[model samples]
Target: MKKYILLIFLAAGITMTISCRKYPVDEKGLLITDNTTCYMSSFNLLGSDNQTVLVTIPTFANGLIDTVKGTVTATAKFGTNITKVKPYCSLGANDMLVDPFMGQWTDFTQPKTFTLISGTRKIKKVYTITVTVQQ
Candidate 1:
Protein backbone atom coordinates (compact mmCIF):
# COMPACT_ATOMS: atom_id res chain seq x y z
CA MET A 1 0.00 0.00 0.00
CA LYS A 2 1.10 3.60 -0.53
CA LYS A 3 0.63 4.30 3.19
CA TYR A 4 3.12 1.59 4.16
CA ILE A 5 5.65 2.77 1.52
CA LEU A 6 5.36 6.37 2.73
CA LEU A 7 5.87 5.35 6.36
CA ILE A 8 9.07 3.47 5.51
CA PHE A 9 10.39 6.40 3.48
CA LEU A 10 9.65 8.82 6.29
CA ALA A 11 11.49 6.69 8.81
CA ALA A 12 14.52 6.39 6.56
CA GLY A 13 14.58 10.13 6.00
CA ILE A 14 14.48 10.83 9.74
CA THR A 15 17.28 8.40 10.44
CA MET A 16 19.51 9.89 7.80
CA THR A 17 18.91 13.41 9.06
CA ILE A 18 19.74 12.47 12.63
CA SER A 19 22.86 10.61 11.60
CA CYS A 20 24.21 13.69 9.87
CA ARG A 21 23.82 15.96 12.88
CA LYS A 22 27.08 17.23 14.31
CA TYR A 23 28.07 18.32 17.81
CA PRO A 24 30.52 21.02 18.77
CA VAL A 25 34.03 19.71 18.66
CA ASP A 26 37.29 20.85 20.10
CA GLU A 27 40.53 21.53 18.28
CA LYS A 28 41.46 17.89 18.58
CA GLY A 29 38.30 16.85 16.72
CA LEU A 30 36.78 15.28 19.82
CA LEU A 31 33.20 16.17 20.55
CA ILE A 32 32.74 18.67 23.35
CA THR A 33 30.84 17.39 26.33
CA ASP A 34 29.09 18.99 29.29
CA ASN A 35 31.26 19.58 32.35
CA THR A 36 30.09 20.51 35.82
CA THR A 37 33.31 20.76 37.78
CA CYS A 38 33.63 24.54 37.86
CA TYR A 39 34.69 25.91 41.26
CA MET A 40 36.95 28.38 43.01
CA SER A 41 40.38 27.04 43.68
CA SER A 42 42.03 29.72 45.83
CA PHE A 43 41.46 33.07 47.54
CA ASN A 44 43.97 35.51 48.97
CA LEU A 45 44.09 39.00 50.41
CA LEU A 46 46.40 41.49 48.78
CA GLY A 47 49.13 43.42 50.65
CA SER A 48 48.50 41.31 53.70
CA ASP A 49 48.67 37.58 54.33
CA ASN A 50 49.90 36.63 50.88
CA GLN A 51 48.84 33.35 52.41
CA THR A 52 46.10 31.91 50.21
CA VAL A 53 43.12 29.90 51.38
CA LEU A 54 42.18 26.98 49.16
CA VAL A 55 38.49 26.66 48.38
CA THR A 56 36.51 23.79 46.93
CA ILE A 57 33.26 23.57 45.03
CA PRO A 58 30.95 21.34 47.00
CA THR A 59 30.04 18.04 45.38
CA PHE A 60 26.56 19.38 44.78
CA ALA A 61 26.12 21.26 41.52
CA ASN A 62 26.16 25.07 41.71
CA GLY A 63 27.17 24.83 45.35
CA LEU A 64 27.91 27.95 47.42
CA ILE A 65 31.43 28.78 48.58
CA ASP A 66 32.27 30.43 51.89
CA THR A 67 35.67 31.83 50.97
CA VAL A 68 36.85 34.08 53.76
CA LYS A 69 35.48 31.67 56.43
CA GLY A 70 36.02 34.61 58.78
CA THR A 71 36.17 38.38 58.87
CA VAL A 72 38.80 40.26 56.93
CA THR A 73 40.05 43.84 57.25
CA ALA A 74 38.11 46.62 55.52
CA THR A 75 40.88 47.55 53.13
CA ALA A 76 41.54 44.08 51.77
CA LYS A 77 41.64 43.58 48.05
CA PHE A 78 41.62 39.99 46.88
CA GLY A 79 42.87 37.75 44.11
CA THR A 80 41.37 34.47 43.00
CA ASN A 81 41.21 31.90 40.22
CA ILE A 82 39.99 28.47 39.26
CA THR A 83 42.30 25.59 38.51
CA LYS A 84 43.67 26.14 35.03
CA VAL A 85 43.26 23.93 32.01
CA LYS A 86 43.56 24.67 28.34
CA PRO A 87 40.56 26.22 26.59
CA TYR A 88 38.60 27.00 29.75
CA CYS A 89 38.73 30.19 31.83
CA SER A 90 36.60 31.76 34.51
CA LEU A 91 34.83 35.11 34.18
CA GLY A 92 32.96 37.31 36.63
CA ALA A 93 30.58 40.23 36.13
CA ASN A 94 32.89 42.53 38.04
CA ASP A 95 36.04 43.31 36.11
CA MET A 96 38.21 43.16 39.20
CA LEU A 97 36.87 39.74 40.14
CA VAL A 98 37.83 38.08 36.90
CA ASP A 99 39.75 34.88 37.11
CA PRO A 100 43.54 35.02 37.39
CA PHE A 101 43.17 38.70 38.20
CA MET A 102 42.94 40.89 41.32
CA GLY A 103 41.67 44.24 42.67
CA GLN A 104 38.18 43.61 44.04
CA TRP A 105 36.98 45.69 47.01
CA THR A 106 36.24 43.89 50.29
CA ASP A 107 34.19 46.58 51.98
CA PHE A 108 30.87 44.73 51.79
CA THR A 109 29.86 41.08 51.97
CA GLN A 110 28.10 39.66 48.94
CA PRO A 111 27.91 36.71 46.64
CA LYS A 112 29.42 36.72 43.19
CA THR A 113 29.15 34.23 40.38
CA PHE A 114 31.72 33.12 37.86
CA THR A 115 31.12 31.45 34.52
CA LEU A 116 33.59 28.95 33.20
CA ILE A 117 33.64 28.86 29.42
CA SER A 118 35.68 26.86 27.04
CA GLY A 119 37.88 28.69 24.55
CA THR A 120 37.55 26.06 21.86
CA ARG A 121 34.19 24.56 22.64
CA LYS A 122 30.62 25.65 23.31
CA ILE A 123 30.28 24.58 26.92
CA LYS A 124 29.67 26.47 30.16
CA LYS A 125 30.10 25.80 33.85
CA VAL A 126 28.61 28.09 36.48
CA TYR A 127 29.58 28.60 40.11
CA THR A 128 28.84 30.98 42.96
CA ILE A 129 31.64 32.73 44.89
CA THR A 130 30.97 34.20 48.30
CA VAL A 131 33.14 35.96 50.86
CA THR A 132 32.13 36.49 54.44
CA VAL A 133 33.29 39.51 56.46
CA GLN A 134 32.43 41.44 59.58
CA GLN A 135 30.15 44.48 59.45
Candidate 2:
Protein backbone atom coordinates (compact mmCIF):
# COMPACT_ATOMS: atom_id res chain seq x y z
CA MET A 1 0.00 0.00 0.00
CA LYS A 2 2.85 2.39 0.84
CA LYS A 3 4.56 1.64 -2.44
CA TYR A 4 1.39 2.36 -4.40
CA ILE A 5 0.84 5.64 -2.49
CA LEU A 6 4.42 6.74 -3.19
CA LEU A 7 4.04 5.96 -6.87
CA ILE A 8 0.83 7.98 -7.05
CA PHE A 9 2.45 10.96 -5.32
CA LEU A 10 5.43 10.79 -7.63
CA ALA A 11 3.23 10.74 -10.71
CA ALA A 12 1.25 13.74 -9.48
CA GLY A 13 4.42 15.70 -8.77
CA ILE A 14 5.85 15.00 -12.19
CA THR A 15 2.59 16.04 -13.87
CA MET A 16 2.43 19.26 -11.90
CA THR A 17 6.04 20.11 -12.70
CA ILE A 18 5.48 19.66 -16.39
CA SER A 19 2.27 21.72 -16.30
CA CYS A 20 3.96 24.57 -14.39
CA ARG A 21 6.69 25.16 -16.93
CA LYS A 22 7.82 28.81 -17.01
CA TYR A 23 7.27 30.65 -20.25
CA PRO A 24 10.26 32.63 -21.51
CA VAL A 25 9.72 36.36 -21.97
CA ASP A 26 10.26 37.58 -25.49
CA GLU A 27 13.45 39.64 -25.81
CA LYS A 28 11.82 42.40 -27.83
CA GLY A 29 8.34 42.21 -26.25
CA LEU A 30 5.18 41.75 -28.33
CA LEU A 31 5.16 42.73 -31.94
CA ILE A 32 2.93 45.57 -33.17
CA THR A 33 1.93 45.77 -36.78
CA ASP A 34 -0.16 47.99 -39.04
CA ASN A 35 -3.29 45.90 -38.45
CA THR A 36 -3.06 46.20 -34.70
CA THR A 37 -5.65 48.37 -32.94
CA CYS A 38 -4.44 50.02 -29.75
CA TYR A 39 -6.90 51.27 -27.17
CA MET A 40 -6.36 53.76 -24.32
CA SER A 41 -8.42 54.13 -21.20
CA SER A 42 -9.74 57.35 -19.67
CA PHE A 43 -7.49 59.40 -17.39
CA ASN A 44 -8.70 60.32 -13.90
CA LEU A 45 -8.05 63.82 -12.54
CA LEU A 46 -7.82 64.48 -8.81
CA GLY A 47 -7.88 67.96 -7.29
CA SER A 48 -10.17 70.54 -5.71
CA ASP A 49 -12.16 70.14 -8.90
CA ASN A 50 -12.97 66.58 -9.88
CA GLN A 51 -12.73 65.81 -13.56
CA THR A 52 -12.45 62.95 -16.03
CA VAL A 53 -10.89 63.08 -19.44
CA LEU A 54 -11.38 60.29 -21.92
CA VAL A 55 -9.62 59.72 -25.20
CA THR A 56 -9.04 57.00 -27.74
CA ILE A 57 -5.25 56.94 -28.20
CA PRO A 58 -4.52 56.33 -31.82
CA THR A 59 -2.61 53.30 -33.01
CA PHE A 60 0.50 53.48 -35.11
CA ALA A 61 0.99 51.82 -38.42
CA ASN A 62 4.27 50.38 -37.24
CA GLY A 63 3.64 50.32 -33.49
CA LEU A 64 5.46 53.13 -31.62
CA ILE A 65 7.44 53.87 -34.74
CA ASP A 66 4.72 55.14 -37.06
CA THR A 67 2.44 58.14 -36.62
CA VAL A 68 -0.46 58.00 -34.14
CA LYS A 69 -3.63 60.10 -33.82
CA GLY A 70 -6.52 60.40 -31.35
CA THR A 71 -9.07 62.71 -29.74
CA VAL A 72 -9.51 63.98 -26.15
CA THR A 73 -12.57 65.45 -24.39
CA ALA A 74 -12.69 66.60 -20.79
CA THR A 75 -15.52 67.20 -18.32
CA ALA A 76 -15.06 68.88 -14.97
CA LYS A 77 -17.18 69.43 -11.88
CA PHE A 78 -16.59 71.65 -8.85
CA GLY A 79 -18.89 70.90 -5.93
CA THR A 80 -22.34 70.51 -7.54
CA ASN A 81 -21.50 72.42 -10.70
CA ILE A 82 -20.41 70.84 -13.94
CA THR A 83 -18.49 72.42 -16.78
CA LYS A 84 -16.53 71.51 -19.87
CA VAL A 85 -12.78 71.93 -19.70
CA LYS A 86 -9.96 72.27 -22.21
CA PRO A 87 -6.58 70.60 -21.96
CA TYR A 88 -3.28 71.21 -23.74
CA CYS A 89 -0.21 69.20 -24.67
CA SER A 90 3.43 70.17 -24.52
CA LEU A 91 6.43 68.90 -26.47
CA GLY A 92 8.36 67.49 -23.53
CA ALA A 93 8.71 64.43 -21.34
CA ASN A 94 5.14 64.42 -19.96
CA ASP A 95 4.03 64.32 -23.61
CA MET A 96 7.01 63.86 -25.82
CA LEU A 97 7.01 64.56 -29.55
CA VAL A 98 9.30 62.73 -31.95
CA ASP A 99 11.09 64.72 -34.61
CA PRO A 100 9.51 65.34 -38.01
CA PHE A 101 6.05 64.65 -36.57
CA MET A 102 3.19 67.04 -35.90
CA GLY A 103 0.61 66.88 -33.13
CA GLN A 104 -2.57 68.87 -33.45
CA TRP A 105 -5.67 69.41 -31.33
CA THR A 106 -8.91 69.09 -33.27
CA ASP A 107 -11.63 68.26 -30.72
CA PHE A 108 -11.94 71.69 -29.09
CA THR A 109 -11.78 73.08 -32.63
CA GLN A 110 -8.81 75.33 -31.84
CA PRO A 111 -5.05 75.35 -31.68
CA LYS A 112 -3.89 76.09 -28.14
CA THR A 113 -0.47 76.27 -26.57
CA PHE A 114 0.46 74.04 -23.69
CA THR A 115 0.89 76.10 -20.53
CA LEU A 116 2.38 75.15 -17.19
CA ILE A 117 0.11 76.05 -14.30
CA SER A 118 0.73 76.37 -10.58
CA GLY A 119 0.14 73.49 -8.23
CA THR A 120 -2.57 70.98 -9.21
CA ARG A 121 -4.78 73.44 -10.99
CA LYS A 122 -3.89 71.95 -14.34
CA ILE A 123 -4.15 68.44 -13.07
CA LYS A 124 -7.93 68.32 -13.52
CA LYS A 125 -7.66 69.88 -16.96
CA VAL A 126 -6.63 67.48 -19.68
CA TYR A 127 -6.47 67.57 -23.46
CA THR A 128 -5.72 65.27 -26.34
CA ILE A 129 -3.66 65.93 -29.41
CA THR A 130 -3.81 63.96 -32.63
CA VAL A 131 -0.30 63.00 -33.71
CA THR A 132 0.78 62.52 -37.30
CA VAL A 133 4.19 61.27 -38.38
CA GLN A 134 5.67 62.39 -41.66
CA GLN A 135 8.75 61.34 -43.53
lDDT of 2 at 110: 39
Model 2 accuracy (lDDT, Cα): 0.32
Quote model 1's TM-score. Answer: 0.31
Worst 10 residues of 1 by lDDT: 81-90
Residue runs of model 1 more than 4 Å from their true location after superposition: 33-115, 118-135
Please estimate how well model 1 matches the true structure, expressed as its whole-model Cα lDDT.
0.38
lDDT of 2 at 118: 18
Cα RMSD to native, each candidate? 11.3, 14.8
Error of 1 at 123 (Å): 6.5
Provide the clash count, candidate 1. 0
Q: By summed lDDT, which 10 consecutive residues of candidate 2 come out lowest?
A: 117-126
Q: Model 1, 95: alpha-carbon shift in Å? A: 26
Could you tell me how far off, in angstroms, the CA of residue 76 lies in candidate 1 after the best superposition? 22
Q: Count the backbone clashes (under 3 Å) in each candidate.
A: 0, 0
Instruction: Assess each prediction's global lDDT (C-alpha) against the native.
Output: 0.38, 0.32
